[model samples]
Target: MKIRAYRSYFIQELESIFGEDEAESFFYLILEEKHQLKRIDLALQIDLTFSENEIKVWNVILEQLKQEIPVQYILGNTSFYGLDFEVNKNVLIPRPETEELVDWIIKSNTKDSFSKNIKILDIGTGSGCIAISLAKNVANAQVFAIDVAENALATAEKNAQNNKVEVAFWNRNILETYDLEEQFDIIVSNPPYVRNLEKEEIKKNVLDNEPHLALFVEDNDALIFYKKIAELAQKNLSENGQLYFEINQYLGKEMIGLLEKMNFKNIELRKDIYGNDRMIFANR
Candidate 1:
C-alpha cells in the first residue's frame, strides 16, 4: 500500500482519540521511528509503498493507540533535554515540562560562580531524565538519583548508561529516608505531585497507561514528596545550595507557603511554556 494512502486511514482512526493535529503528529513520529523517514521524505517519495510486513506492524501499533497506550511506550524510547531515554511501564515518560526544569538547573549553574565539581541529587528519578540531562549538560557534575521502585531504579540506571553520563542510582524511598550520606550543591526532584483528585484532569492516555506511583499522591497530602525532599535538603544541601522541583500546577501558593514556613530563602515559582506554575526553586 502506498504510504500516503495509509496516512489518511491512520489519521482517521486516531483523530477521535487524540485531536487531528496530535494524530497527524503521531503519524510522522511513527514514520520516523519505524522507517527512518521524515515527513519531507514521505512527501518527496509520494509513491512510497509499505510492505505487507510493515503494514502489519503499523496495524499493531494502531491497535495499541486505540487502547490509549502512549506512543513513547510503543516506541520504547523518548527524547528529553536533547538526549534519548528508554521508557516503559516501570517509569514515567519524560515530559517537556520536566525538560524546562532541567534547563532551569543547567542555566542557573552556568550563571553562578560555583566550583566545577558540583554534586547534584535527583529524588524519585524515574527514567533518570533530570539527573542524566543535568550530568550531560553541566560539566564536572556528580549526579546521584534515588527511587522507591527497584524497577524504576533499574530503568534509570540503564538510561544513565544510554545517555553516556554517569549517575549513581539508589533504590531508597525518599519518604522514609531522613538523611543523605553526603551534601549536594544542588538537589532536584520531579516527584509524584499529581493529587488523586486531579486524576480526572489527566488525559486518558496518561491516566490509563502511565505508572501511578510516579504520577500521584493522596489529594489530602499532595505536597508529601515536596515537604520530605525539602526537609532532607535542609540537612544535606551545601551552604548556598539550590533546590528545584517540578510541582503540581495547582499548588503554587501552597508550595511557596511551605518553603517560606521552612525558612528557605529566595524561593521562586516559575511557569512552564504553557504558563502553568509547574516549577519552583529555593536556596538553602
Candidate 2:
C-alpha cells in the first residue's frame, strides 16, 4: 500500500480523538518512528510502499492511538536529554519539560569545582531520565537514583545500561526516608507534583495511562515531594551542594517558600520555554 493513502486514512480516523492538526502530527510521528522515514521522504517519494505486514502492524498502533494512548508509550521508548530510554506502563514517559530540567541541572553543576568527580542523587527517579542524563553528561560524576517501585527501578536500571552510564539504583520511598546515607554535591528530582484537583487539566492520554503515583498529590499537600525532598537535602547534601526539582508550575512560590523555611539559601525558581515556573534550584 502507498504510504500517503494510509497516512490520510490514519489522519481521518484519529481526527475525532484528536483534532485534525494533532492527528496529522501523530500519524507522521508513528511513521517516522516505525519506518525511519522522514516526512520529506514520504512527501517527495510518492511511490513509497508499505508491505501488507507493515500495514497490519501500523493498524495495531493506530488502534492504540485511537484509544488515546501516548505515542511514546506506544513506541515503547522515548528520547530524553539526548539519550534513548525504554518506557512502558511501569514507568512514566520522559517529557521535553523534564529535559529542560535535566539541562538546568547539568549546566548549573558544571561550573562547580570537584575533586575529579561529583556525587549526585536523583529522588523519585522514574525511568532514570534525570539520573542517567546527568551521569552521561557530567563526566566522572557518580549518579544515584531512588524509586519506591521495584518495577520502576528495573526499568530505570535497563535504561542506565542502555545509555551506557553507570547509575546506582536504590529502592526507597522518598517520602518515608530521612537520609540518603551519603552526602551529594547535587540532588535532583522530577517527582510527583500534580494535584488531585488538576487531574482534569491533564490530557486523556496522560490521565488514563501514566502512573498516578508519579503524577499527583492532594491539593492541600501539593508540595509533598518537595517538602520531603527539601528536608532530606538539608540533611544529606554536602556543603554548598545544590538541590533541583522540576516542580508544579502553579506551586513555584510554594516550593520557594518551603525551601526558605528550611533555610535553603540561593533558592531560584526558573521557568521553562513556556514561561511557567517549572524548575527550582537551591543551595544547602
Candidate 3:
C-alpha cells in the first residue's frame, strides 16, 4: 500500500474526532515510528509505500486511534526532556509541562551547585521521566524515585536503564510514608492533582486510557498530595533544599498558601508554555 495514500486516509478518518491538525500529527508520529520516515522524507519520496504486513499493523493502530487511545500508548514509548521513556497502561505518559518543571530544576542546579553527592527525590515518579532526566542531565547527582504502583516502578526502572542513568527506584506509597531514608537536596513530584470535578475538561484519550491512580484527587481534597509531600519535604530536605511541583493550574494560589503556611520560603509559581499556572518552587 502506498504510504501517502494511507496517510491521507488515516488523517481523514481521525480529523472529525481530533481536528485536522491533531490528526496530521498522529499520522506523522506513526510514520516516523514504523517507517523511520520523517515528514520531510515523505514529501521528498512521494512514492513511499507500506508493505502488506505493515499496513495491517497500521490499520490496527488506526482503529485504536478512532477510540481515542493516545498515540504514545499505541507506540509504547515517548520522548520527554530529550530522553526516551517506555510507557504502558501501568504508567501515565509524561507530559511536556512536566518537562518544563525538569528544565527549571536542571537550570537552577547545574553541575556548579551539585557536589559529588547531591541527592534528589522524585515522588510519584510515573515512567521515571523527571528522575531519569535529572540523572542524565545533572552531574554527580544521586537520584531516587518512588511510586505506589509496582508496575509503574518497573516501567520507570526500565526507562532509567535505557536512558543509561542510575536511579534508585522504589515501590512506596508517598501518602503512607512518613519520612525518607535520608535528606535530599531536591525533592520533586507531579502527583495526582487533577480533581474529579475537572474530569469533564479532560480528553477521552486521557480519562479513558490513562491510569487514574496517577491522575486524580477528590474535589474536596484536591490538595492531598501537595500537603503530604510538603510535610515530607519539611522533614526530609536538607538545609536550603529545594522543592518543586507540577501543580494544578487552577490551584496555584492554594499551592502558594500551602507552602507559605508550612514555612517554606522563596515560594514561586510559574506558568507552563500554555500560560496556565502549572508549576511551583519553594525552599525548605
Most accurate candidate by lDDT: 3
Determine which window of 10 residues in candidate 3 has minimal summed lDDT. 109-118
Candidate 3 positional error at 215, Å: 0.6
Task: Kindly list the per-residue Cα lDDT of model 1 for residues 97-146, writing each as its tens digit.
Answer: 99999988898888355556899999999999999999999877999999
RMSD vs true structure, all candidates = 1.1, 1.3, 0.9
Output the lDDT of residue 219, model 2. 86
Candidate 2 local lDDT, residue 166 = 95
* Candidate 2 lDDT tens digits, 1-284: 99999988999999988999999988787788888888999889999999999999989999999888999899999888878999998899988889998887777666355557789999898899999999998866999999999999999999999989999999998888988889899999888889889888999899899999889899888888888888888889998899999999998888888899999899999999998999999899
Clashes of 2: 0
Clashing pairs in 2: none
For every model shown, what is its TM-score relative to the native structure? 0.98, 0.96, 0.98
For 1-284, candidate 3 gives per-residue lDDT tens digits of 78889989998999999999999998998888887899999899999898989989999999999998899999999999888899999999998999999999999988887557889999999899999999999888899999999999999989988989999988888889998979999999999999999999998889999999999999999999999999999899998999999999999999999999999999999999999999999999
**Rank order (by TM-score, best first):** 3, 1, 2
Question: What value of lDDT does candidate 3 attain over all alpha carbons?
Answer: 0.93
| Deviation of model 1 at 142, angstroms | 0.4
Could you arrange the candidates by lDDT from highest to lowest?
A: 3, 1, 2
Candidate 2 residue 246 Cα shift, in angstroms, is 1.1
State the local distance difference test value for candidate 2: 0.89
